[model samples]
Target: MSLASQRAGLSRLPLRAAAFVVLTCVAILGVSGWREWAARDAVLKGAETEMANVARSLTQHAEDSLDLLDSGVVGVVSRLEMDGTGPSTIAKLGKVLEARKTAVARIHSLAIIDDQGNWLTSPGTIASTLSDDTFFRHHQLSPKRDAYVGHPVKSVLDGQSVVTLSRRFNKPDGSFGGVVLATISAGYLSHFYEQFEIGRNSSVALVHGDGLIIARNPNNERFVGRSVADAPLFRDPSLQRPSGAYRFKSPLDGAQRVSFFKRSGRYPLLVLATVDQDELLAPWRAAAISRMLYVVALVMLIAIIGAVLVRQLQRGQRMAAALVEKEAHFRLLAEGSSDMVTRIGLDERLRYVSPSSNRVVGWRPNQLIGTDALAGIHPEDRPHVQAIVDAMKRGDMDEARLTYRNVHRQKSEVWLESTMRVTRKDNGTVDGVVAISRDITEQKNLETRLETLAIEDSLTGLANRRRFDERLKEEWARAYRDRSSLGLLMIDVDHFKSYNDEYGHPAGDACLRVVAKVIAAEVQRTGDLAARYGGEEFAMLLPNTDAAGCARVGERIRSAVHDAGLVHASNPAACVTLSVGGAACRPAFERTAGTDSLVEAADQALYAAKDGGRDRLMMSGEVTTLLPKASGQ
Candidate 1:
């Protein structure tokens, strides 16, 4: 019965072992290849997030620079229009301009140019007709009244590359009197981008909405002021989005890149943060190759181990010890990995845990074995984690990855991420589950910080315009749903330009900071938000507030600033004061309804307060206000 049959079975072992080795290699290749793809996706997403962060930071820098220029130019224009165009007035203004240029290092030049090709500050530029200048023509012809930013040009006085930011003033008779011109060094602005640590071949740029490159990092002087109108960033679909990210091949160097672009809120400007795709993926590519090589070695090791097991089976007595040795060999493989590995039984108890648990989660492998698998996870995250495990046990899923929090450890939060797979018996029925986990607290903290930076203003440490816009939209929807009142206060520092003019920009900054603190201290409600709206302007948004209540809050903020007693020589009150205007309304839900009317009304009242002597509060709405009725009432 035995000799021939045993001989045939022994002969078939080589073919069976070869088949098993091939199948194991195929499975390893499939799983490892999927992981490689996921790694690439993670690398690309990280680049996208980094580019977004850099773009936002550059946008803020550009905004602050423009604000500084606006403050100086506006102050000069106001003084010239009111003080008259006499020779004495022109002489006095010229001296003031020279002083400002000296005080602020960033200001290349500041001048008042007449309608007739004459420069009040510089006698040399008189021969060069200022009347034909792009900035001059913009102010002379366009009545838009906002500050105008012209293309970069070589300064006539010194041949330095400069960008002109100008505003026009009118005579009391409504005649075009002259233009206030301020130039800032384009090099200074572009150089600000060099501090970022983006890869070598990567670049950053500031582009006009009309597709002009105002400045660029990794700078070439020849590239400044060049038009990139046909670049992917300025193309049709890209232009349609205010801010977005995309992948494209650069026309300048033909390098593929992952780039992010954002448009500035108040200006026709955009910021581009481009990352070179090759450099971005270099580390990931190297790691991926290493991993595939490791998989190949692992497959060969498994085949050799299986052949030895078959040899032990032939001897019959050594089979039991060989199986135990194989288990230990696989354990060594798990321990060599960076993650903490664990195996769970159907009873949801840990059957085995890798030694790396001590490093990853501060728990020894022996201490975790036989314990409930979900016990260490936070209560809120346990249910979902268990659901994933159960689904895998039922063959509904073969693999899953999840991130969750751990139960309190020593006095700090711990975030953990897990990649899990279903373990099966030779009969193909699910036995239990196997998992790999690693601590991800650092990553979680970094993400939180990035989110905060996106919303908060770096200078004043207050809610920035972006945060305010997001909150405004959210509050608007809530107000509409409840038929509740939303109150808004528009606060502007009174005669701020004159203050900047008298004390210089540094003192002006300190004065604004003091006022900002005073305004912030008045809004005590969790729902009320106070934001730095823009240069010298602050806003307080009060939800469920009536016009009277909003006016009271404005009065408190005004009184606080007055009490702070920061001196402002140019202000009529002899102190820094605020012109505050409040508007409140019960929102009626409609598809097209928005906060535009409320903003407009508050703005009108703000202008009225400014015209009616500076330091006062004005409220916009009926004295007898009607409230939305509740169903019971």
Candidate 2:
């Protein structure tokens, strides 16, 4: 009986050994294949990151160049605004333009065009009309006065290609006056693109949001100014985002590329940087092939020692059981934990969702698994969230924290602040991401409400001092840039202390509210600001307004208060009256002083008004003008 059983077992030994060898070889191939796949993924992600950084660098450089051109153009525009485009001014402007163009190395030419697009002056030898140019047509048709960056075109004066950054100037009556054009040579930008060290078939370019290739590296003139409007990247809704990256076949050359693009927040400019996928993965492919060959050799060696792996087979089963138990423990903790935990793949699909998702975002675990992680994200916030995820996937960061809005299953928008960690494979390459998000809607709302109250005056419903100071600083910078005037008016309730003592505090507050209302109503311009500076005193900020305009507004306020007819028996006028003072100054680019000087001068004028009489408006000596005394005075 024993001889038969032993013979049967001995016969099955070779078959069992053969099966072990085959299974071991298959396992080695599978693991090696997965590692090679991860290596390729790493290569692609690294290439994308490199492209993104290059795109960002190019974008910043472009913005700096455009900004330099803008400053030069703004000065010329201001001159044309202050002084008409008469022959004398044009002759002087031509010389000024030549000097400026020489001083600014980036500018190829500077010219002033008439309202009809007649070139009034050109730094080039030949003056030419730009009546049919895109820039001229844009300024003529659109009332917007912001700087416009036009497509590449051959300059009529020099017969060379150039990109024009133009601005529209206005007449004294705010009518369309003309355009100030600053030209940047295309050749110079091409030279600037030469510094990048991208490999073969790679490109760096400046693209317009409308899909015009404004400029490109590798010195491809044929690609410049070409329309790529129908390209996948341009057609995608992501074009509206400030910055993003995409991988697609080039519509121009049909080359596959992992193109990274960054869009300018201020201009219609796009900086594109790309790397040829095949070239970028060349090294990875070589290494992967060699590693697979090694795996094949190791499989043959394992086949000879198949019997020796019996003990390892038993150990592997034990380890697998332990891992299964550990995974179950993790699930238990995830389900019981208060915070919602999720694992998201690079495709933005949820790999794992915890039970707490129901309590967190009003979705069950089953409802979220295998669904797009971004489906619940707010439309406006998805771009930023996607960028953060991309950065982690690209190995730029190991952990990230962000706050975003999520649409709850109940149809409510809830703010969620999440802390995310990049999950990695054993090869140290990225796997996906693990994120823990908690509801922050309540905290965010409270913070927003508190911020609003911080800058508002509760008593008079006007801007408080903090807000006034902040706005004045910004307006001062704007006025300094445009070389325009900034006016400030200080108003004080005449005999306010006496009125408060006689009529009680409540009545005094009511009077202040009424005064604030009058000040706000009188200063109604888009750039105007009326603030309750402090108790019983208010301030009005008028940008782009001259001294006479400020005095007129001050007079209106005083006369309106006098007409209000609020009784004040303790005062000499027997009614509430305002002592108003106004001062204006054309902000100078050469000045180093801040807006504090303007406020101090206006305050001095208000004291003068109060000293002369209780209810009168006084103008500072910046301009020789003063309104007639108010009726109460």
Candidate 3:
């Protein structure tokens, strides 16, 4: 062949080789991309299946709980019909209601009301008549024998949100004889829903057929009883089936989510389990991006090799330098991340720490490098971090996302959420872990503050009535277990309405604050609690205290308030004086002497104190007698 022609053929050879390499690279990436997409679809499908199963399980559980509650109500109804509503029969009914309430953790209260909506038997005192309540009216109007679960409402007894399940009882003439009620706190279902770890921005909800949200995780009190009848989750024909999945935007929070829903087989209830689409696909997107980068890099490297074979050593060196530049770019991206990026070695030492460590944990890269990464973890969180690290090392977990506390340079604890992946060798041997951590201390602190606001009274800085009720129940149960006396003192500001009308609302509030402080000071035991029961009323719960002790404390509280000398021009005493009543009893599981009875007794004594004379403490008994005068009195 001629020299020019041979040279042309050789150049064409290189060109042909480059074209072939490019096509092969494209083909490989195309197949890999298809596989990755398939994998992503599989992950999503698996998640949907899992969520469906969760929805079904939760629905079944809710149905079973309701059925059990309904059975209890039915049994009570039968007994009431057989025994009638005499004092003895009411006492027996009270015992039965108490036993049911004790046995069922979810039941907040159990009561039977008369035709006039007066409670015939209750676990606690019914603070207000439920004559106008929806459930009460429903039972009075509709003679349905089925148990009806009502929308959430602030319970009349303790003022916490509760879902009431009521069954109507009939008189001999078949007229309504009021309803037997079983209340479950909406907080109970929310708390139960929190047990499942779905994902960030995920939610689980139990909704009634009428579209009232009975309970939900990420529990917002405002939304608990709200109706979502017009929402797509309820209105869409596709979602009305027994069980299904769909993508919809949440009406409550306005977030788009993949929702799985199941209708209860027994009750007019439904369970919804939702996961945010962004969160659900986040891992898959990351994996796809990583795979795409790997494919691109491999194609670039193959092209470089093909050029090197065509153009000898000089071109090969340039292409190698280009590859190095790409590596440097990746390193720059990692180091520039706001999150602390770290790679640990097989020896459990940090092989690399991103520069962001200084911003995250106030530690320099060199300070963290070559050191045990878990050593900086808070003592309480070290074990969990160690377990995750150990799992990564053992290849038991290929990826893990964990939240833990880390010790900052100032000795303050900082919460960090870390996403980590296990690195492996070509032979599939475990190498180390690569982790990215972001500080979440502020988020956690905000959550804590929000939680505090929910349970605290902004005015008196005491636990609100809701918290007080919860603590009282807990203490009552504990005291019952120990066979110890539980004392409850009810205090009311004498002529408080007149004070409010005379002093103006703000000054009246200040007077109440002083009274709250006095009560808190008098009940200073660690387990004791003082709370603003309502406007112009306060209560103190004394665990392990007897009637005499409670009376002494009550007297001290009254004396302290009288001494504070906040003038109340409208009162007979001309000062803010308290009328205190106390009752103490050993809580009994089988008898009617529960927290409610103690409260009722204290209330009766409080009324007696007001009737005898203001500014005195009274103890409940056959004949209410005044407490001995304080030293000054």
Off by over 4 Å in 2: 1-23, 123-132, 157-159, 238-240, 300-633
**Cα TM-score of candidate 1:** 0.47
The candidate maximizing lDDT is: 2
Q: CA lDDT, every prediction?
A: 0.81, 0.84, 0.82
Candidate 3 lDDT, tens digit per residue, 1-633? 333234335556657766787788788888988999898888778778878988988898888788878889999888777777789988987887787788889888788888897778753544352323788889888979888888777766555678778998888777888788887777888888888888888899999888998888886576787899998767888777888887788888888788788988777898899998888899899989988898888888987887776666445445544533434555698899999999898899998888999999999999999999788898888898899999889999999999999989865879999999998765678878999999999999999999999888888888889989899999999988898888889999999888888878998888888887877787577999988888888999999998899888998888988988888777788888889988887765324444666777889889999999989998995111222121112
User: Tens digits of per-residue lDDT for model 2 on 1-633?
Assistant: 233234435545556766878887899989999999998998888888888899898889888989999998899899999998999998998898888888877788888888986778853532552223888889999999899999887666655567789999998999899999887777677778888888788988888778888788876577787899898677777655766768899888888898788988888888889989999989999988998998989987887677566556555545544433435766787778888999998787998899889988999999899999888899899999999998998989999999999998885889998999998765678878999989888899999989989999999888999999999999999999999999999999999999989999999999998999888898677889999998898999999998899999999999999999999998788899999988898766326456876787788799999999869998886532221121111
**TM-score of every model versus the real structure:** 0.47, 0.45, 0.47
Q: Which pairs of residues collide in model 2?
A: none
Colliding pairs, model 3? none
How far does residue 410 in candidate 1 sit from its true spot (Å)? 3.6
The full ranking of all candidates by lDDT, starting with the best, is 2, 3, 1
Off by over 4 Å in 3: 1-327, 588-590, 622-633
Instruction: Please give me the total number of clashing residue pairs in predicted model 2.
Output: 0
